[model samples]
Target: MDSISSRIQEVTPSLTLAVTNQAKAMLARGEEVYGLAGGEPEVDTPDHIKAAAMLAIQEGKTKYTAAGGIPELRSALSEKFAADNNLEYAANQICVTAGAKMACFNAILAVVEEGDEVIIPTPYWVSYPEMVRIAGGKPVLVETKESNGWKMTAEQFEDAMTPATKMVILNSPGNPTGAIYTEQELRDIGEVALSEDIVILSDEIYEKLVYGENKHVSIASLSKDLYDLTITVNGFSKAYSMTGWRLGYTAAPKPLAEAIEKIQNHSVSNATSFCQYGAVAALKGNQGFISDLRDEYDVKRQFVLSRLKAINNIRVVEPKGAFYFFVYTGQLGLKSMNLTDKLLSRYKVAAVPGIAFGYDEGIRLSYCTTLDVLNEGLTRFEQFCREH
Candidate 1:
């Protein structure tokens, strides 16, 4: 009638994007602002992929395609899963969406019902719980300790389950935490999932960003049973620097995949047709660009860790993958938002407050910018901490 629905009302806006945008506004006004709030890579999209898109446009491949995705892209994705992740998926089992986030959203909405419980670990990506809430599901958050490397143990998973539990979301090389669950650890969790018959949404968007000896293993790849129960979500945003292209996909069981496709039919129809050609190139082209990006991010990761270790009064869990350091600011005795505001207003640096990610004692700093920019931001951040 007179106003928006309660569903829309319940959604909290993304504080991460808000802080990044605010920092950009300051820079536009000639202020020297160092922004660490954004979650995108600074690298430009690879030239080969861009060329593919241009070729698609020239060939007039811009018309509407299938609601799921073009067969070519889906076929490439199927091969990607088999070769890289050690998981086999038919082209029909894949649903290409606008982004990995949308793949997750559609998966949650397709299976989760009112009052169903979706288990999410603490200090998770800000979107998971909200997406569950939007689907009329209860988000049951289980806290994972910093001492535990922000990983949920099998015991913790067991304790969180209930008769109403419908799904569990996993972000390996997790956002904010950068924690990748080890193979044995995933097996332990997978054991619980199998025993409980809970569906797993494995978000492996940052799969290519691991550091040191940490290997990214798809939990679904561990066993046939686990594979049957998992919906593996991935995209080109992180690995290929294709965030603006809005391409991501999911490989699920055929039945679940069809349900997601039906939802897509009524929603945004499908991902852009020509952009999908770029995605195909991303999957099939020479992957040397990824190794270069990883080498650069590895350097940044080491620099970030060293800098954080030198700072006093803050404890940062050393991250093994992804581009963030989730620093604990609890000892400062200020709420995370207040701490972020102080950093922004006093030092002209931006980072997402930890409260936005379901933790109150910390903030998240992304190292997706250039090394010089990151160094400058950390300098201001250190000065702010010292002055306060």
Candidate 2:
């Protein structure tokens, strides 16, 4: 048999998936693992959203619609951008795909030719660098150390740019650390990206999930130059608790979006027709449900942040948004993977190793579980830290 492509070999398995699977296998053997490694909300899709999908399917809305998106959904999503985000996207500039991840992949493939460079900030989404490599481009990662709450500075961004830079991937309400970028900070990065002539792929998947006083900002809204150069990749999964629906959309400059649409034409054809209808409901229907969910996440966030702070050997930057807390567990004299193992084996607590998210000596604990269960998981985290 022929060997698979070298590109496939170069891409490492997602560390988060590997750790999650190992913990899952242990649970299958009857171990009581708390499994705080997942990045999703444990909450179910809202009843109204579910009802909408059922209605669509029953109405025989299962056939292929359009490559870009159904007109109704695009129009609704466009209105959503204007209503919620203060951004305008006509139907021509929009294309809906499988999920935000696929939208990101589409953006990368659209812009990244072989050997080109894409600058990714460290403590980034676990998949960004790997996806860049898979698309035959180099991933240029710049560090955002813990002291700065894992944020990229204007100077750091300046140092990472070069003539060959094709794109910069920005993730706010960032995964693992839960660091939400402010509008002023995005304006600074937007300035850098525009000056460098690099395309910006702003991944706003966590836009609606922010907590406390932090607000999610779109980098494209910083200026007209940015609006023309930015590919805004967002989806219904994180915001609407609709991960299983697998619908995401991107609004980009017309010429750039043309390339992404072509790729979508050949690869996946179109997102499920029924799901698109459901997404319309998610976008235009009562959105107070999201706020209700965010309120619960805030309670859990404060609880986990406070509990993790009291531990002696571990240091965690309190997450400002999203549902993650990245804990620096290096002082325990154990690498993060080993620490994860010990935590699972001894305390039956499952947390992803920090190395999974590009930082060694730390671990990511998700607070997306229930109020009672979230507290119990933190107690297990404390037990694991103390015993080590």
Candidate 3:
């Protein structure tokens, strides 16, 4: 190959995937490794959803359908946004795609252009900045601190916005940090975004994975102006344990939804046909599965927090949502990548380095594994810290 496109060059490999794969390779070699890197839920796809997919297959619903999504699933999603999030959206304003990741990608491509600045918060999901880079938009990262719960402030949001600012990416029940913005926090930031006329790509993929007294609030539900300026991206993966089903959708204003649909149409050409039915089943049939899962996750979250607390010289804010603990390891006197590599190669524990999420001297530990695995990993991590 002579040379790859610069756009492709601008993108970086996902650190979460890299750590997960490295752990898998270690296990393949018959080594004992505790993989605490990935964010995917360990639960199987719910039976009702799987049954719906099977029924669709039996009924010959495997053929190509609408480029955006099946009408039934879109309608179900519209009802879901309204009933659950208090956001009114019609099927015509929804664009379903392969994953919430793709939904975000489509929305970014639809709205962002060259030289446009997209404001993102620090300790963000690894993909947000890379997606902006690939879209030819400059990613303006606003650093939020652990002291402030890793949540962006209205002042920071305003300070980052320039005349060139075109969009802002918001991830709640956020990855790595597990921080969820409160209704007031979102309203404050939403005001700045509204005043600047910046569109918001609100990634709510982890909305249902929240814990404690914490609640997930959609900025779009705060006001009509916020709703018009926000692209709410959600999916069946986190809530329904349908990661492999690859079905996610965005609810936006009609014109933006159409743009997302057009991008989805020319690129992936809709999600898998039968999987859409499974998603429909997920939205319509689910009532109790998520609650039970949340209870279990809450227990696991506490266990992880306790383990991290016992380890000396590690600083971690208690996570209120999602399933991660962003543990600061600056006292260990190692770069984040080196610390992560040592954890995997020497300690037989796998974790993603904080540098991957735009934070230094830290690592992200996901507690979405079995109790036995979590115990072993935390034990090894504590021992490694003591040795250092």
Candidate 4:
């Protein structure tokens, strides 16, 4: 008999983590490996944020507070939502988790029941489907066209809906593909969700990283109906370069917030006590760090875009937000896994296989590293394409 529960058996490990681990292993062996597989920014957390955490420790704030989060952090986030996203979420209606990832999982587990369906667009974040499956729900994948900038349309969402459909996940400045949904586009989709009373899990973790004319609009802020049906998830990982801090929060209606809080109560208990203070500092302290980070990412994005355009047999859409490029590598005559394997093994550049994001024709490359690393990595990548 199988020792593991069937639920645990059904989940697939994260391919992105696997690739990154292999790259780290190569580097440990004193090998020169260009790592572009990581999802977080390659920067240190702001000094003020670190100071806040240290101060908390100095003040003896190590004990566990409420499972959701400290009142100060939640209240600060409440103000942040009002000021940044134009959404009103009372402190009681927010639940802070270990990371934005936990916030998403708690939200999923709070609403998704056995045999329920959750709609996720293609080229989704690697963890979405796994999270849904972990909650005993079915993940309905809708294939989005690269021509449409890898965004799911209202019509496509409506067509995929069934009686079992309970939620739809939207990641603006999406991972793998940095597709930002416009306000009008969100309104169209919101209308359908409202009619069906379907919940919307809006992941805006990369909201502050957006560039050019693209704006990050929270679907929950579009209208009252959409607001009632949405769960907004954000964190300090990407924006504040605090990935190791493991701070993220979810703002939903009171009932959903309470349910997610209950889940947190039984699991990790709460986000690190001192880290909550750091997150509070992130929200209330200097806002200039965000704009500076966005500017740097934008510069790197443009540099990578130009280099990829100069190479043959690969096509990439210029990302409007976020630091990733979902490069089409189908013309190289290999699926994403094999392509990435050869790229890593032969060319010594590490990148994530597109199949991990449900797009086998492409691979995902992050420009979060230094420009020198990106330059050398892209050079080797160009050679790989030429030989193929």
Candidate 5:
């Protein structure tokens, strides 16, 4: 008899993927799907980035270059960290991985040990705790209040600490909720992490998608000490609409960076070669497409927010970044899975169950599709809520 490893067995398959795949299957069967469950931008990759990748292929730059990343791309990332986030990292201090998801997993695997605790706030991106578990670390989830905009307070961070606490994961302009941590709030959390000597894994993949007066702040940039304690993870997937490109990176203190690179060396080796060239182009080329996409998302976000507000029996805090809304469906008197199942099966709308994000009272809806789909999906969703 064969058996799966306990670590792998303990992990739950990503429900976000499950929902998206189901929606895709329905669409494949010629059923109309609103397709509000995906986490990717529904746009073509910018032409210049594609041209750069094609150029790399033409130049035969397709062979494996480095486990961490190609030097040129890493150097480009070094400048990106400085110019965009106000954090300084030499090329050697960065490790490029297959995607931001892998960058996160590599950082966790490098540091977390058995019995160590990793604090994760509630309504987090569904992957964080699972990554910690795979690394043999206990994920200590601290429930955050909805009234506080679903953000964990610094006091809450300190309260969650134990002698066994080894790390804390922070996602800003976060997934599911789209909550952006303010600069002062980051300072307060940094102070707590500093006092406890906890490693910070800051996921800022949604950094470039913020709206209005809200700005994305890298927690590592708050202070030198915080920078030393942080492994900042970011990627091109969200910002550049390059999800299929499979590129992202981690910038850490020297030792931590070395360990993450070692893990990368043993695992998926390197991100795709020509894609690295594309990422370089994504970094160095024209940035207007990002703003244009953001402007479109902002319009969809407002339309969804207004529609959700008009619906009875649900509540939603406005998301200032990223492209999702974690709408509270508690008053509809169904758990997220049930609500989402009914929405998909009966109303032809697909959404991620918020239970996947550790919040059973809500469901996450992505506004990454066209306004026409948004209008139709929200109309059906409103009908579903009313009947329930």
Candidate 6:
């Protein structure tokens, strides 16, 4: 009999990726499937960013870089964090990784220890809990309700903490929920983390895509105490539409940054050198393209939410940020997996089931594609409800 490590056995496969892969295979087989299952932007990487990468390759900057990051990219990220989020980060306080996923995993490895508790609010991205489990920390989940717009309450978070709690991951403009945390709400949690000496891992990768006048507040700005305890996790992926480049960086206390660097040194070693150059260009070049993408996303968000809300059994909150609309489909009485399967087989409108994100009552739809595709997908969804 073959034996795998207990750690490997304990971690489960990513459900969202599994469903997405299945849909991709069908699409490859000539099915006209609308792919709302992918967590990436459908838009191509803008020309200027691509041009920068080409220039980087021409200049021969494509070799190994420092395990942490290139100096220029680190400085740009630090400045970007300070200007955009009002959080100051020195060069030494930054660590660039392959993606925000690696940045997050490295952060967890740096801070979490065996038997430590990492509080993860549900309706979370598929990776958070699995990453914690891999790090030898128990994932203590706090269920964030749909009625509250999925922003967790102070009480819910407080009830989940113990002396062994080392960190709490807060993904605002969250992945599946798209619920933006009000400033006061973030402050409430920030204060608690400060009190408990729990580190706040603020995943603000979607900070730039918010709709309306709802601002994305950085918890580190709440107080100096909270600032010291908070690690601001952000990337070039969502904001600048650079997901494929695999460039992400985290700004934490200098010591924590060092520890993450050590892990990187032993692991993947650095983010791609040319990609780091492209990331620097992304931060410094035209900011207007981001606004252009956000405007389109806002239109899609409204269109999809209004359409879903009109359906009898579906409940969709107009998402305040990001590209997703997390709609409750619980009345279908179909386990989310079955609902998704039926949608794929019969309707060909593929969306991610909420069960993948640790919730079973709903599904996530990405409106990141063309308006025509979104409208067609919504039409299929509307019909699916009626027929079912």
Per-residue CA lDDT of model 2 for 50-75, tens digit only, reads 88889999999989988998999989
Off by over 4 Å in 1: none
Once model 1 is optimally superposed onto the true structure by TM-score, how far is the C-alpha of residue 274 displaced, in angstroms?
0.5
Write down the lDDT of every candidate, Cα atoms only.
Answer: 0.93, 0.87, 0.92, 0.94, 0.94, 0.88
| Candidate 1, 26-71: lDDT as tens digits | 9899998888889999989999999999999999999988988999
Alpha-carbon deviation at 223 in model 6, angstroms: 1.2
By summed lDDT, which 10 consecutive residues of candidate 2 come out lowest? Answer: 1-10
Show where candidate 2 strays beyond 4 Å: none
Give a tens-digit lDDT track for model 5, residues 271-323: 99999999999999989999999999999999999999998789999998999
- Global fold similarity of model 2 (TM-score): 0.97
- For candidate 6, write residues 1-388 as lDDT tens digits: 2498788788889887887798889988998988777778888888888888889999999899999899999899888878888888898789999999998999899899999999999889999999999999999989988889897898889988899999999998899889899999998888788788999998988999998989999998888888888888888888777887898888888778888899999999999999888888888998999999899888888888778888998888778998898888988788888999899889998888888899899899988888888888889989988877
Candidate 4 accuracy as TM-score: 0.99
Point out where model 4 deviates above 4 Å.
Answer: none
Question: Ten-residue segment with the worst summed lDDT in candidate 1?
Answer: 1-10
List pairs with backbone clashes in candidate 6: none
State TM-scores per candidate.
Answer: 0.98, 0.97, 0.98, 0.99, 0.99, 0.98
Per residue, candidate 3 scores C-alpha lDDT tens digits across 7-40 of 8887999988999998998899999999899888
Cα miss at 94, model 4 (Å)?
A: 0.6
Backbone steric clashes in candidate 4, count: 0
Query: Counting only residues 3 or more apart in sequence or on different chains, how many pairs clash (N, Cα, C under 3 Å) in candidate 6?
Result: 0
